[model samples]
Target chain A: DQQVKQNSPSLSVQEGRISILNCDYTNSMFDYFLWYKKYPAEGPTFLISISSIKDKNEDGRFTVFLNKSAKHLSLHIVPSQPGDSAVYFCAASNGNAGKSTFGDGTTLTVKP
Target chain B: GAGVSQSPSNKVTEKGKDVELRCDPISGHTALYWYRQSLGQGLEFLIYFQGNSAPDKSGLPSDRFSAERTGGSVSTLTIQRTQQEDSAVYLCASSPQPYTANTGELFFGEGSRLTVL
Candidate 1:
């Protein structure tokens, strides 16, 4: 019962290029989604999030697109940098606090 | 601590031994959660606690697994007679607001890696 899924295990892109990460969920009840970036031996840092009511959310070079009807969302980083290389996780949750379900994670590597 | 803190970053225990992992959430946060993850695997929900409410332990794998939150701040996860399969990273997270249906974000710890030999 994997409610959230990130099919792509790894992604590679060149510096200053666009990096897109995809995520899908099976439970329509989920109304909030978030993305987190994790580095080796460190906690996952909060990146960005979107509510089901909105279709898109952006912050600086990071943007999150949500397609509620399709139960899918994606994170886009424009002009990706080497510092952006890390394991990105997509998590979803319903009304339950502290009960978010997480995807396996996508490892993104930016080549300089 | 400025963020969630988990102790015993790495632990190696023999099979059948018990182990305890600790987590200290942010000072003012109200919601705390525990999750397990294997290498290259997704986070697995283990338990959830909010304020003084009863914890949600539906995700716990078995009776051998138990956890408790004390003084509404620190949490301890104890595994009795740990099995080889019990080896995994234990992560703890906290949220300022109780994540309702509309919004919420989690602040996670680095996670405690457990190895059962």
Candidate 2:
């Protein structure tokens, strides 16, 4: 069973525009959510994360918002750059459980 | 040298052969993890190691899969009698600890792709 899901297979946006990627989870036990960006032939790289206690977190140009009631989360990239093009994955963990479940990634393409 | 490193970046083998993949976690990191990614699929959890304690191998797909972490630094994943279904990219990651206070973020190595004919 897929505990986490990213419905969009791919997305395209113009440079300097806002890019939004969405994710949803069915596990209520997951307390922490993270977003990772992966490039070709490389492993996923940590981008940003949010705790269950907070509804939103922002780092530089990346922002993550969580809606506990809806079991949904989103990653938003402002002023998207060509270099930001990559596959984005959403993952979740439950503290010491130490095992993270990932969603099928969304490939983002930024046209310059 | 600074981040997690995996060896045998690419491997191709015939069916019924066994394959071994290796991972070297960053220095001083006590937590290690292994995952597999198939084409057009998300990362699938395989195993986790913390220090000298036992590893969590719950996500292992079958009895043919086994892994071992030695000296709390390096790990090797072994697949026996490999089949075409075993072909995928294997990834390794490391963290300082299990919780958010010390090692919430995981540093991953470029995956090793295995192809079984």
Candidate 3:
């Protein structure tokens, strides 16, 4: 079963616009959420994360909003740049210091 | 310090063969993990290793798949009697602290792409 899900397979947006990516989870035990960006043939880089205690977290141009009641989260990129084009993956940890469940990932394309 | 590093970026082998994939986690990091990603699919949890604790192998698909972490540093994932369905990119990651800390972020390697014919 897919514990985490990213419904959108791909997204396209113009440069300098705001890009929003969404994710959902089925497990309530997950207390931490993270987002990672990956380029072709490269490992995913840590982008930002949010704790279950907090509803939102922001780093530079990236912002993550968490809604516990809905079991959903979102990542927003402001002033999206061409270099921001990559696959974004959402992952969750159940506070066990063990395995993490990852979403299918959303491919973002920024058109300059 | 350098990030996680995985070797043999690409591998192609015939069915029934065995293959070994390697990963070197960041120095001093105590937590390590392995995952697999098939084309157009989500990442699949495979195994996890923490300092001195029993490694979690529950995510492993079958007995043919086994992994070992040597000296609490490097890790090797061995797949025996490989099948074509095994073709996918294998990824490794490490965190400075155990996942329970809730503050550590997972640093990933570029991943090794395996192709089984």
Q: Which candidate is the best by DockQ?
A: 1
Winner by TM-score: 2
Q: Which parts of model 2 have CA positions greater than 4 angstroms off? A: none
Weakest 10 consecutive residues of candidate 3 chain B by summed lDDT: B96-105
B1-117: candidate 1 lDDT, tens digit per residue: 598999999999999999999999999888899999888888889999999999999999999999999999999999999999999999999887777333467889999999999
lDDT of 1 by residue, A40-93 (tens): 888788898888889999999999999988899999999899999999999988
Give the runs in model 3 whose Cα sits over 4 Å from its true position: B100-102
lDDT of each: 0.91, 0.92, 0.91
Weakest lDDT window of 10 consecutive positions for candidate 2 chain A: A91-100
Candidate 3: residue pairs that collide? none
Clashes of 3: 0
User: How would you class the docking of model 3?
Assistant: medium
As a whole number from 0 to 100, the lDDT of residue B20 in candidate 3 is: 100
Candidates' chain B TM-scores in the order shown: 0.95, 0.96, 0.95
> Following a full C-alpha superposition, what root-mean-square deviation does model 2 have from the true structure?
1.2
- Model 3 quality (TM-score): 0.96
| Residue B68 CA displacement from its true place in model 2, Å | 0.6
